[model samples]
Target chain A: MSLVLRETALAFRRAPLLSALSVTTIAFSLFVFGLFGLVAVNIQRAIGNVAERVEVVAYLKRGTPLQAVALAAADIEAFPEVESVQHVTEQEALARARRDLREFQDIFQDLETNPLPASLDVRLRPAFRDVQRAAAVAERLAALAIVDDVRYGREWVEKLDRLRNIAGAVGTVVGAAFALVAIIIIGTTIRMAVLHRSREIAIMRLVGATDGFIRRPFLLEGILKGLLGGVLAVGLSYGGYALIDAYLLRASFFTAAQATLGVAAGGFIGLVGSLVSVGRHLRST
Target chain B: MIKFTGVTKEYLKTGAALKQVSFHIARGQFAFLTGHSGAGKTTALRLIYLAERPTAGEVRVSGFSTARAGPREIPRLRRRLGIVFQDFQLLEDRTAEENVAFALEVTGARHTTIRPRVMRVLTQVGLAGKANQYPRELSGGEQQRVAIARARVNDPVVLLADEPTGNLDERATRGIFQLLKDINASGTAVLMATHDLDLVRSMDAHLIELQQGEVVYDSAEDAAGRQPVAP
Candidate 1:
């Protein structure tokens, strides 16, 4: 353990510039990945909020008995996908229309009979709030004997779902590409380090040092680089997030758990990249 | 102890570097491998150290057959032998003591054991006062001494020197040779490869001369015992 630490310290002392360059490259790459993660998280939260409010409105036929309407409402309420169902009478519907059209309330007073149909407002469970499932539920309601029409904003919900899917796919592809670049950057840095210390390696081999002995210091060097880079990336990402929140009122987009995961992933990539580079060079020599 | 029986090494780029060469050095025995450049003297030493394998025959070092040793076993085999080169190969940024400590560090020796052992070897090589000096600050002879101290730090059974005096002045060469002789006197077998015929003759040690890739002479059997064979 002391040997590893000493060698790692020596390596850093030997090439401070190169070490810093590697760490900075890793930090920037992880920062980009963290930014994408933040955006994706916010997009998902927004989509979920929109989906929660999705409800199917079923209009009853004119002159339908209240008892039949109540029976249909009870049947809809029994569905696994249904969260809650509210029955609105004709008078209540007319009153709601009057409240919504307050600027023209005098026109509603001239009508002797109420023109608004009674309806059932059906709220769906969160899991069944997707466009396809909600549309399926609305179709089943329309087939009921008392229901005259069903509406669930099918077009708008579909558009929102498509947007969410596209965002997720884009985030994944971009994140993977950035991760690949980080690995390549770290690999190149470690390869340069191996080349720089070729003489030391040759001497180590000459003095009966095993492959593991020679590789330990370099492996430790890579781990240190990755750890430092991870810390830097986390700091930069959190600082950037705070700035965004202060300026645009978008605070709390990235959670602490997500930042931890991102840093851990970055550190792991750095370690793997360093190992591959060192292993390749050692094998070739 | 080292033995090479009908050893042949063929490189793709250079063809056969050594052809059917055979030799042996018993425990506590010292010998010189004398030849011109490309005469396979270094190749012979490398075989013993497991740096290169015999293409056609066997090489046994410290009772382990290098030909059959796996990658994991090679280092274990190497630990029984020490190697020195023409270039000092010392880490320029490190102090002389640290360079010597490297050998012990690779073997996972304890820190308390490493410092005393390193200082003892440095003092043995007559560089005790220069232990804290870097390679760049040390003279050529001092740097080479540090390299020798590093090789001796592990107390290997067989010390292989590949042109150890190639880059030294005559005075420094004499000092280095005397140091190697002192090391040999301590029961560590030494196999030194060099083309300095005059030096080889003056030492009165066993000499195995190589021409091309074949053994041309073996002083152990006297010059009249073996004729020069072409590869």
Candidate 2:
């Protein structure tokens, strides 16, 4: 170890209270950053997972034949965006209605024949499961001569898309904000370290020590601060991830909670790294 | 050797403290700068240390003109000049030996060379046995002696003392002067700024008196106590 390192060790040994406070501040800030990070990650994952379940339903004309419905289903399945297609015959539709509304069967008892329409259930490929793709597939299917109508939870899907966009944008902004905060916190922490040892700096100047040699101790000090804060933040964030995931699982929102925790860890790392570096530099000088 | 020509230093509130002052000290020479308070003695000493640049004129020390000295050369110059202050600014936490070793450490003195050199200087100042003691544990006289040991560790070409004995008793003051005289006899020039007229008179050394800001009397006292170089 160089003289400054050796002396820096002595300086730390002499002032436990001051060093502990600085490190604690770093850890606390990192923990907060980690929490926000978790919120963002899970939102993204939940949006993606939910989008995969969305699909379009195309209803055929009331008198359409089984062969026509089957051919249409096969044709729809061949589309680049379509994942798969299932043809529902009028008989199947009637049976489903009978099972669902057995008590209301009297309301339709006067019907001479079932007027139920056969339909094609189109599941789009995962890449096209978003609102735009779902809407486009519905429009395209409705344009077909054999299709009479197309339907889906249009407003709900639109709202989900909007929410996903807003959430993703917020995640970006929050990540940037945390990064900036980490830099400021580190810089201020290091500045405090510098102020603490100004006398030693003056003495170093008097003793014919170069500026580079004088700054070494504080740099080491900042790194130690970062490492301590980093370890704490990482440790705390891991616990937070587990706790949040467990709560989400119990509440049946596990997917979102899991996704968000990943962001939390990233935030923790950023917070710890920036502060320790800045703190050490500020103190060393 | 040192020289001051047409040197002037001033602050806005405290007008000119040194004005067009001119003096010179030759190689291996000792001098006393005697003055009352606020007589620019501290300012004069400060200029030699390159702590304050002069408002005017040329001041030179150890062959380099300090007025024209750049930042890089300042440390080099300081390494060659030993300074002792009235407050005896020793690190209170360090051993007497460590305190002395600081001077050598800064100048890149090897660790193996520090121990014996520190011991020799402490022995010279009659503080050898107390090397392991910290400054706070020592008496005022002993602390001053430790300060002297620190100054001498670098084997500086010139030693400057500013009221070194202000905090000491009469006998202690006498001993401090004797130590300075012995160092000067061994060839390092000593410039002491003091108000101890009784001590100055008994020592029989060259004397320069400054009142207000300018020198009023210049008696370059030889070893036998007579003005040898008249200006």
Candidate 3:
């Protein structure tokens, strides 16, 4: 081992209790930040997953031609905001209506000629699915020739806009708070290290060691603590997400397909955020 | 060689610690700096080591100006000379060999070269058997031996000792002096600052006495006119 690393390792080993104290303290602070990082990621992804349901539905005119219905769906898909288009034929619509009416036996006397018009369900790309953007898309679809009505959930879309805004605001505030807390904890930990090893530093200085060489090991220790803490926090948050997912599936609501889709995105965010925080701590003091 | 020209040191809180002091020690010369307590003995030693910048006047050690030496030059200047503290200043956590090797390690010696050099020096200081012993395991004089080993490890051109025998008994003091004499006999300049005036008188070595930061006597120059003292 090089002398600087060897000396740092020796010093740390000599006082394992103090070194462990620094590591765990740094880990706990980073853990809090990492957990929040995961929460924010999952929240956005969940909202996004549910928000996919908010699509512009182009209801066709009564007695509209088969060719016209297909043409309308195709035209809607051509819009930059539209992701995919599905054509619900008149017969299919009638069957679905009949199934609904069968639940209330008194309402459906008979399944006669299908009166439900064929409609186009147009799912939107994530960026254009916001309430304001979705409304613009709906208006543009209504302007189409064969569209009898351009319908998307005005109230539902508006509610989601509000909810998404609230989530974003909460994420920002919590992120900043946890960031401050983490920096303070790490700073205090480093300052404690400096104070404890002041004598060692003074002697090293006396022996011609530059300031940079002296500070390197402490910085490495800080980074290690942060990375380990990030792993732990990710584990805790994943466990929490898993438990929630399990409960949802047990109650016959959302399934495993729902959570796994967002897991990769969430994990990426957590790892990056933890690394950035640790880097900031290392450079700051 | 060290040359202090009109050098004066001041402590702001106490003020005027050392008056304008002037002297020179040539290459491979052994001299003793004798003074009373608070007579600027440590201050004089500090000037040569660049431990403290003089409050006024210029001081040069081994041709590097103390007042103007940059960061890069300071280490190079210090590498040429060695200074031992009065308190030994041995790390309590390190073995005697480790303490001696610290000097070489700081100057960027290769790890392969350091072990052998540390061993050779420790053996020279009579601490070869005690290389593995920690500072607390050794007595005051033995610990001082470890420190002397550290000072001379890199084969410094000049060795400065500040109150090195303060904690030793008469026998240990004699042993330490004999070691210093042996090192000097090999042509490495040795300057020991001490309070033992009787030891100074009996040794018949060159002596320079400082009283209140001014030279009071010079044995080498005064003895030049008198009959030469026995070797």
Candidate 4:
């Protein structure tokens, strides 16, 4: 193992320029992938923020007692998908309309009796905030004795679902494409490194070195380069994130685990690239 | 010991390199393979080292036969023998000592033993003082000596030299030839391929001459017909 390390060091020392070039190339490739990942994460967060507003409002009958509505709220909150249920009095509903819909102030001010009905505002959990789940919960709420009608903006919820699905699908496909490009570029850079040392490899084989022995140093070099490149890529991605956050809209950087995964992906790509390049060199010569 | 029986090597592009060539070298013998540029001398040496297999017949070296040796066994067989080329195939980036140590290192020799063994062979080739010098810093003759030191570091049973002195001047050629002679005197058989007829005539060594890929003359087989010989 020490010998392997020594050989790896020797290779780097022998061609520092080429080694640096390889690492830089790998870093940039992974950087592109990292940029896409950042975009995907931010898009997903935006969709999630929008989904949080998804709630079903069940309007109560005018003659329903407040005591009965409180009991219904308790039962509705017990549902697995229900995050929370709030009972809004008819007066509170009128006040909300006055605060939220300022453009309809003239009509609301002229009203003698409160036209709004008391309602149960049912907010679903984030996981159950899709069109289908919201509709299912609305159906259940409307079946209650006191619930005269239910309104959760069916078309709006469906549009949000469509937007979420498109974002997820596009994220996956683009992410995969970027990752594949990064791998191919990294593999090519490592191949150039292997070819740079072709003479040394030929000498090793001539001196009776086994294929495993010949591959060890190159493998180590590849992994090390990959790891370094990965860290560099993460750094580059962070720089990009900072620039975007400062100049454009505020954006979320990768979580700690995601950043670590990015580094590991770099190392993994390096290993695979070195394996292929060295394997080809060994087989051909 | 090295022996070839009816060895024929055919390439797809160039056709046959060696055509039914046969020769034998006993243990501890110093032999010269003399031929013109395209006379299959390198191919014959390559066969002895297992770099290329003979299309027909067999190459038996130190109990390993080309017909029977598996892929896994090739490195093991190579470890028992030393191979030298005219270009002095040393890693240019490494020092002479490092180049010599590479051979021992490949065989997984003890790390502690490598330095001493490398020094011994470098001293044997009279490059003990220049062990730290890289190949580019050394002359043609000195670089070849480094290569010889690397070859001899393994204490191989046989040394196969494919035009070891082809790139050297007359003085360096004499020096390398004397070095090989000294190595041969220490009981390691040397089979050298060279087109230098003058070098072939310089000493009383076994000679094999190839012409158009056929062995026209072999000192050991003046009377024996082209038949397989059991070692």
Q: Which one wins on lDDT?
A: 4
Q: Candidate 2's C-alpha lDDT?
A: 0.77
Q: Residue B152 in model 3: shift from native, Å?
A: 0.9
lDDT of 3 by residue, B33-62 (tens): 998988888898887777778988888877
- Over the stretch B115-227, how does candidate 4's per-residue lDDT look in tens digits? 99899899989999999999999999999999898888888999999999999999999999999999999999999999998999989888889998999888775546544
lDDT of each residue in A1-285, candidate 4, tens digit only: 899999999989989999999999999999999999999999999989989999999999997998999999999999999999999999999999999999999999999999999999999999999888999999999899999999999999999999998998999899999999999998999999888888888888888899999999988898899999999999999999999999999999999999999898888899999999999988887
Q: Give me the candidate number with maximum TM-score.
A: 4
Q: Could you give the interface RMSD of each candidate, to one decimal?
A: 1.4, 2.0, 2.1, 0.7
DockQ of every model listed? Answer: 0.68, 0.35, 0.35, 0.82
Model 4 C-alpha lDDT versus the unseen true structure: 0.92
TM-score of each: 0.89, 0.72, 0.82, 0.95
* Candidate 4 ranges beyond 4 A from true positions: B223-231
Please give, for residues A1-285, the per-residue lDDT of candidate 1 as tens digits.
877888889889888998898888878877777777776777788788888888899999998988888888888999999999999889998999899999879989789988889999999998898788898899999999889999999898788778878977887898788767767776787678788888778778767688888888887787777778878988888888888889986656557777777777766876787688878877887
lDDT of each: 0.85, 0.77, 0.75, 0.92
> Which 10-residue window of candidate 1 chain B scores lowest in summed lDDT?
B222-231
Identify the runs in model 2 with alpha carbons over 4 angstroms from their true place.
A44-48, A51-161, A168-192, A239-285, B12-15, B204-206, B220-231
